[model samples]
Target chain A: MAVLERSYKRYAGALSPEWSRFLIIPRHAFRDVFRSKLFTGLYALSFMAPLVFAILIYLRHNTEALAIMKLSVVNVLPIDATFFLTFVEIQGWVGFFLALLVGPQQVARDLTNNGLPLYLCRPFSRSEYVVGKMSIVILLLSSITWVPGLILFGLQSYLEGWSWFSQNIPIASAIFLGSLVWILLLALLTQTISAWVKWRLAASAGLIGLFFIPSVFAAILNQMLATRWGNLLSLGSLIRSVWAGLFGTFVQQAGQVQRMRGGVIVETAMVEPPLWASWLILFLICALCLWLLSRKVKAYEVVK
Target chain B: MTLDAPATSSHLNDSPGVITLDNLSVTFGGRPILKSLNGDLRGRAIGLLGPNGAGKTTLIHTLLGFHQPSAGTARILGSDIRGEANQIKSLIGYMPERDSFISKMSCIHFVRFMAELSGLPPGAALERAHEALFFVGLGEARYRNVDTFSLGMKQLAKLAQAIVHGPRLIFLDEPTNGLDPPARSRMIKMIREIRDSGQANIVLSSHLLRDVEECCEEIVILKDGRLVVYCNLEEERKANKKFLMLETRGDLKSFVEGIGSLGCECAMTSDHRLKIILQDGTEIRDLYKLAAASQVQIRRLTYKRDSLEDIFLKAMENGSN
Candidate 1:
């Protein structure tokens, strides 16, 4: 009873007017995803990928001996941190996929399933629906990417050593915040696409195409036109790689920050944009997408 | 997008009705689905009749607060639907046209879940769901999976959810959509029972004219998003042409000449038969004396009264043509 009451207070105190509506959607959205055969496959793969990676590490330890295994990763040419960036990669793919799945369908469900009229007839306003949509996307992103990634990260970090995490945790905090920004951006991007499209598969393809179109244009320029401008404009890969590059170097050495630019393959860091700008664009796009999404959902007719 | 003025705000008013649409319109992708429509219905059973795409469900949505009008306002009870939707929903029982429950869930569980969604406690939701299933005549099949239910039973389960909250107003949209004739009749009878028992006000929408004519005390008909007809069973009949029909034995030519001169219509039913229909203001004494003088026996005299169905059909046809 105390456990129940204790959790209730904690949950209730975290409430905002918007949060109240969102409370069930996160849990519900997760349930929805698990119910889908395709999503369940993706979910299983997510859990399986890390397990495979963990097994590889375990096998490497057994074959090389635990002491030598630690030496190879922790000491030899290991960037001095033994920083495994697998979780970041997983978060990126999972977050993008989940956002793409839920975004358009949530919008399209109102339009296609003819639930918009019925959903509207409930105690929610049009704007409230918009809020609910965004909140659900955010929750789903966290569920599909951040939370799972963090859990795995925690497990690996604990297995690695308490000292490694205790020393590197601040950088870990920064990485977590950065992951949040990436998730928010992905969510808003999908929502913006869903605003115009009613079907999930089409909206998802459109979203993917939007990201790759930039890449295709970049590839044409980089390979065909011989310009690096193509590389800069590949926003999808840039979004994934840049955030991964930033977060993967968690708990950076203070001296390294002064001596070397982090995670750059091209040696000179002249091409990379500032992280603050990335954050601003993400938030700005979120606000803009929400405004447009509200209009789309509001314009949907529930004439049955 | 929210109106601050209480008088103008259609969402917050507390009027006594299960459902009400004052003035509501819904547009989809720049196409107007519903226009300025108003209906004031106080009967236990009120039918909303219209052709396909005539905004029956749209009006239901507006009454439910799923769609707010662009121009006019709507109110459920005294609260404006735009302002106090939660309050209105708490009292409204809505059975939407589409399938709503998760397919994997059993009928009993789905009803309980929806009841809980409406703010009922778990135990209370269960109790109410059970009672509602029983009331909707789904007692034995309540425990079966919703996927196993026939279309009629699934529809009944949806109906069960709507009433579980004990809302004052209930909206049943195409409740008998896929039902066979007998099932359809049973559904209609259930609606009548729900209303006649005075448990709640029902606004049932269907294209079935017979259902409306039999079950409803009043009907609001919509055509192309516009209200084409609103008939109070008693008032509509009263306003229609009421006249005495007389069966007379005479040559149609003589009866026609005499009745035409008297400003009456002599309808010739057969070779030797004529029906002299008396207009409201016609002097009955004159007709009797004329009949006596002509040696026409008044074989039959009866007042011709129109049924509600006739009024509904005429209104729709007039609106269309």
Candidate 2:
């Protein structure tokens, strides 16, 4: 229709399926997200770690490069569980920073601007709206985390042959599963804060405080009470414990601590919280975030 | 541009009533907001009117499925709001009263986003978004961010998004709120045009009785959470046709006697002014003929039909009783 005619016309076109309608949120959200130069820069920078990991995997297989560097294949960082574990840890932190940059404004913008009714008044539900906003962080973090982590694993599997791939399948599982857990946690936590805080800067600070402040309190508690149970209060410690377990390094990392007492060296095994406790704490935190999210994300507020 | 034939959705039932409230009630924290509102609103443009705190907005919210009805249910386009809210929502468009827009989105993009959420395919949504913007007279500023638009522009943008997807029913909550006179007239004109187009049913909730009186064929007036009045505006106006006011010269006694002989009730408010309540089967022509025959010149004549304000005020009085 020409702009001059200025007549309202009926749209008789076909509609998208109900199930896939939620994808529209992320589709539009991605456009707004990439419009930010800072976010775009950070998102582009996120791939550097994956690119560097791929180079490390390539160098481990290139005997010419290893010899030129005066290093043997054995002396180079082995493409093993620890190697992938370190890769996941670095990518996980990168994903956190990426989410921190983007996630705080996802739900907060809608609530602050009175946009929820526009969404809810459509065929969309509250859960779909939440999932749609959550998908922004989920998709972005997945690309930087497990998606590339698995690609790196596939590269090693292709280069090192079937025997190496068959023997070290757990490392691949750990990279995928561990990154998934962290991504879900970050997505839910950041959205929860966004919904509650409703201010972008304050929400960013809340996300940082949610993770770091608890760890500080946990450290103080552990020192004062002499208990490993304080790890339950620290989300970072709980997630680290879970990641360590997933990578098969929990036992090794918790094996021994050597300290000097009375001018003598005494080696003692450090006590650690049960891996199940960490898993339980993370699950409870995620559940709490979801409950809090459900409470705040509404189209109308009821006043009495 | 040529207009397509009005599209009808397969999901919509061919019911006469656009919205049917079946004893619907809503309470917020034990305080009733809507108390058993029951009516079948079937007009092309239904006006919802009430004083402040009379539950006008709450009724719209309940029908939109924003607030679940505490007692009974309402049907929008033949779908039950309780069981088929999603289906009802798919067939309806809503223009909220408050300022609602994505903070940084352009007018076209915001309307397109709303269209997509309403179930239009992405390409169709973008196309219709442009058409809707143009229709609302925002074509020149479609590229501007909605937040940067003036209040009038924002109201038009909200309207553009509401009608973009060709919904079967639309809920317009205070659509003319905060608009200046020209903008308000433009909004009212567009609303009447939409009503005349026969493409969608409108539920216009507003505090301004003039806005409602101008655009609506049927009205539902609420008072203190109760359905005080529900009637067709044309029928209400027609019912008040018996009352008339007249200014006259010459022999008024003969004219009064002639009016009384026609079974009309006439009261002499002053020497030259008369208030006549015409009886059934009496027409204004009969009075004019009687005045001519009685040698009384009918100087001025006015039919005193009840305005919407009168109807609203009367309803409020009766609701209080």
> What DockQ does each listed candidate score?
0.09, 0.66
lDDT of 1 by residue, B200-267 (tens): 77888988888777778778888888887776765555533346666667644554676678887777
Chain B, candidate 2: TM-score: 0.89
Query: In candidate 2, residue B306 scores what lDDT?
Result: 81
Model 1 C-alpha lDDT per residue in residues A166-205, reported as the tens digit of each score: 8766446644665677777776677678767866789989
Candidate 2 CAPRI category:
medium
In candidate 2, list every pair of residues with a backbone clash. none
Superposing every Cα of model 1 onto the true structure, what RMSD results?
A: 10.0
- The 10 consecutive residues of candidate 2 chain B with the worst lDDT sum are B1-10
Q: What is the lDDT, from 0 to 100, of the residue A168 in candidate 2?
A: 89
